[model samples]
Target: MASVIIIGGGIIGLSSALYLSEAGHQVTILEKGDLSDNCSFGNAGMIVPSHFIPLAAPGMVQQGIKWMFDSKSPFFVRPSLNPDLFSWGIKFLKKANAAHVEESAVPLRDISLLSKKLYEELHQRGEFDFGLVEKGILMFYKTQKAAEEEAHLAEKGKSLGLDMEVLSRDACKSLQPELELDVLGAVHYRCDAHVYPNQLIKGLVSLLEKNCVRIARNHEVSRIETSAGKIASVAAAGERFSADHYIIAGGSWSPAVARLAGLRIPLLPGKGYSFMAKEPEGRMKIPALLAEARVAITPMNGSIRYGGTMEIDRINTRVNLNRVRGIVEAIPKYFPDLHPEMPAEKDIWFGFRPSSPDGLPYIGRSKKLSNLVIATGHGMMGLSLGPATGKLVSQIVSEQQPEIPLSAFSPDRY
Candidate 1:
């Protein structure tokens, strides 16, 4: 069995460790932070199969441009002098076509569905107690135009065999009797699910530890030594770790690690904000996306999590109160009685999503580095796609055929 080293201790790295160890390989995971925190913690806790569409779709360029300057906007692209950002933006604009989106939709949907199933399998093994609820997701919208547009997307989802239903304002109210939804309509996807990220991490960590998977936390990988297009060793934390294979999943900071092996990955950090609250008096069973406001609310564990905002600028971990306010203001609009009274900073949380312009994650070995695998740039779908990604990585490391096509998500596709 090959000895593998996984860099990045987030969900992707931990999940890869789980899959590799289960496959009989000796695995070591290197995390730069305390293995307990990251963007994965404060996510909407969604296993989102309904997110079949890539971010760089038709009309997105226009929308992004319009919202670029607004600090409180759900999406913001801070213009930078960085050449990589420019190239990625240009390529993103080119790929923003209906055809590309349609072509990509199937793969995105399939991987997410596979992940949700894998999550179910893990849950059934009855190893840990993470809140895994397959209560479906509702995309609630305020305007007729918004609802109609989303309904069209929901129809597409239904065609893909996902259980999707377009509900009117009244029908939405029926599904969510607790929340007084102020919306025109909703698109509900029953195939989706939710999970508390910390719980999953805890369970997975225990499982990995039980199986003897080595996890090195609070350390950074400084360099990768290569010979004849193959990785020789990864120098990190005053030691040299040589492995038969390596999976780079450092999340938003992935580019730093990839560069050590001479790979030029155009990965950017898209910062997001989130906070937790007691479940409003009339808590709903299903996790729902507030479409018009672009916020996501999930009944995680027992409490609710309010997460949204895609700020594409400012690399540091600074939490912006204005952006946090935007998400807070949105909560009351949907659940009228819900109040987020805590100081934005106290309840504030920010994490960067390693974003690639085309909305597809880079998930294959680079031609330049024979033994190194690139697995970052997942953007917002990291949690939803973690299992499938780990499975694919295991297959690739075993010299087995990939479970899905890799061309669509190649690191050099750009």
Candidate 2:
């Protein structure tokens, strides 16, 4: 069995450690920050097979340009002089076409389905309940243009064998009769599921410790030692750690981490925000996505969370009040009766998504360094695809064939 060292203690790293340990490998996770607070802890907790199209789809460039002028817009690309951002922008524009979207759909769907199945299996084992429910997601649209777009995407999803149903306003209201929805129509993707991320993170950590996985918290990886085209060790927190193999899953910081190893991963940090409303007065049977606003609402365990806004900017946790207000205002626009009080700026949770230009995650071994594996750049689908990514990483570590094709998500695709 190979001794493995994984960078980052978020969902991707922990999930990878879980599968690696289960495969008889000795695993150690090196986290740069506190384990209790990270990217995977306070996310929307959505497991979506419905999102087959990548972020770099057609018309996104134009939309992003328009959203740039609005501070509260759902998607905003902050102007910057950083060379990495410039390079990423160029690559993003190149891939913003129908061909890239079509190429990404199958692999994205396959991995999501694999992860959904894995989540079910894990939930059935009675490890701990993190509110893993397959109630499906409701994508509600208020305008005719938005409805038509969703219908087209639903048709594409249906053709790909996903269970998608486009519902009229009355039909949507019939399914969600408890609350007053102010949308023209909805697309219910039955292939999706939801989870409470906070619970999942705590549960996974406990399970990993019980299984003898060493978790070094608050230990940041600084230097990567490479010799003879293979990773020798990783130095973090003034300590050198040696392992037979290394996996970098550091989310938004992945690119910088790779640079230490003489590699470049074209990734940009897309910041997003979320806030929870405890014991909401409105009733919600399932999670819902407000299409026009790009906000996601999930009724987790006991509280309700509203999350949205993807800001492509530098790595920081600064809370933009305008963006927070946008989420607050967007909530009532869809759920007419569910106008919960807006969360304070301090109460909001924000994190950076490791977004790749083409919206495909890097999930394979390094071509130059045979022992180093790259598994970051998941963008908005990290939670939805974590387990499958972990499982695939293990398969790669064991020299077994990956269950799904890796061409689309290759690290060298650029």
Candidate 3:
């Protein structure tokens, strides 16, 4: 049995550890910070099969250029002189086309479906309760143009065997009678679902610990030692960690971690913010995405979460008040009845999503390193794709065929 060392204690690492241990491998997870919080936490918690389209799609460049002027825009790219940022931007611009979208749609759908199924399987096992709700998601659009676009996508989803429907204003209101929605229509994606990310992590951590997986919290990976084109060991928390196989699932910090192994994985940290508030007097039953505002609203077990903003910037934890204000302003526009008080700046939770230029995850063994597997660049779908990614890594380590095609998500693609 191979001894596996996984970097990052976030959802991806934890999920990989679960599957690896189940496969009869000794797994060790090294996390830089406390396992309680990461990008996995403070997310919208939506398991999105509805999100088949990649971020780098046609007309995105034009939209991004327009949004650059608005500080409160949901998608903002901070201009920088950083060489990595410039390089990544160039790559992103090149791939922001119809071909990339068409190429990415199937793979993204496959992974989301696999992860959604895995979540159901985990729920049936009754090992842990993480508030796994399969109520699906509503993509509400305010304008007729947006509604038509979504309807087109819904047709595409239907062709792909996804259960989708274009819901009129009345139908949407019927599904979510609690909220007063002022929208033209909505696209209901029945394949999508929601979960409580915090609870999911806690349950997974508990399960990993119970299964004898060594989890080293606060152990920051600093250096990777390599010999003969293979990893020898990794230095973290002032000590060296060696294992039979190594997996890098460090989320936004993946590129930096890969540099230690003399490899370059182009990844940008796209910061997203979310905050939970007490459920409104009449909370919406289903999770909904305010398409025009680019905000995600999910009603969890106890509280409701409002999450949005894809600020592509350097890695930092500073909270942008304008972005938070934008989210607060968006709520009343979408749900007229819900008037939530603006949360304090300190209460706002922000995390970086490892965004690839092409908007597909990096999941495969490195071409240069035989014993190392690189898995990151999941972007906004990290929570949705975590379990499927973990299962794929396990299959790779075991020399078994992956459940889906990995050509689109190859770490060495770029």
TM-score of 3: 0.99
lDDT of 3 at 253: 88
| Model 2: lDDT of residue 40 | 80
Q: What does the lDDT read for residue 331 in candidate 1?
A: 76
Model 2 Cα displacement at 278 (Å)?
A: 2.3
lDDT at position 140, candidate 2: 96
| Global Cα lDDT for candidate 2 | 0.92
Query: Which segments of candidate 3 are over 4 A away from where they belong?
Result: 280-282
Against the reference, the lDDT scores of all candidates come to 0.85, 0.92, 0.92
> Model 2 segments beyond 4 Å from truth?
280-282
Q: Please, what are the lDDT tens digits per residue for candidate 2 over residues 1-414?
A: 999999989899999999999999999999998887888877999999999999999999999898888888999888879999899999999999999899889999999999999999999999888889898999999999999999999999999999999999899888878889888999999999999999999999999999999999989988888999999988999899999989999999999899999999999999999999875554788899999899999998678988999999889868898988888998888888888687877888998999999999999999989999999999999988999999999999999999999888898787
Candidate with the larger TM-score of 1 and 3: 3
Cα shift from native, residue 238, model 3 (Å) = 2.2
- CA RMSD per model (angstroms): 1.3, 0.9, 0.9
Candidate 3 lDDT over 332-374, as tens digits, reads 8978877767899888999999999999999999999999998
